[model samples]
Target: MVTFIEKGFLYGFILGLSLGFFIVPYKEVFPMGEGVTETTYLNLVDFIIPLIRVGVITAVIGGLVGFFFYRKKIRAYNNK
Candidate 1:
């Protein structure tokens, strides 16, 4: 089974990307007014770079947290 930290990171990454790519873009999604053009969404490729960076960073941090907790538990068990 995946540890809680791994699960939390996976959920966080998916949730973060979904909101970043979909919900956040709506900030600039105004209707085109007279003689004005609507802002364009970031290109898929452009979004991927930041998306991957966020995902990797989240995963690594989560793994480290999990490792720390695992080590703590091991030490506690050994001391018992």
Candidate 2:
């Protein structure tokens, strides 16, 4: 589970970097709206993107790993 979480974090980091570099601009991928200035936009790219990525990926991977393990254990128990 921990390993899966760590891998997810790493993957999220890569994803965030790519998002910040390309998709985030033009308010397309995750729009901050028209009121946001360039400074705020840059700040978001630096801060918000990683935070969002980490959170999303951590939850997703942790849940998936936990579910798989739980199901496996249940199956094993049922077999016996």
TM-score per candidate, in order? 0.58, 0.41
Q: How far is candidate 2 from the true structure (C-alpha RMSD, Å)?
A: 7.1
Off by over 4 Å in 2: 1-45
CA-lDDT, candidates in order: 0.65, 0.58
**Candidate 1 residue-wise lDDT, 3-72, digit = tens:** 7567756765765666555533422455778877777677777777777766666666666666677778
For candidate 2, what is the lDDT?
Answer: 0.58
Please provide, for model 2 over 5-77, each residue's C-alpha lDDT reduced to its tens digit, 9 standing for 90 to 100: 4665566556655555554443324446897633423455566665666557655665566567766777899
Clashing pairs in 2: none
Worst 10 residues of 2 by lDDT: 22-31
Q: What is the lDDT of candidate 1?
A: 0.65
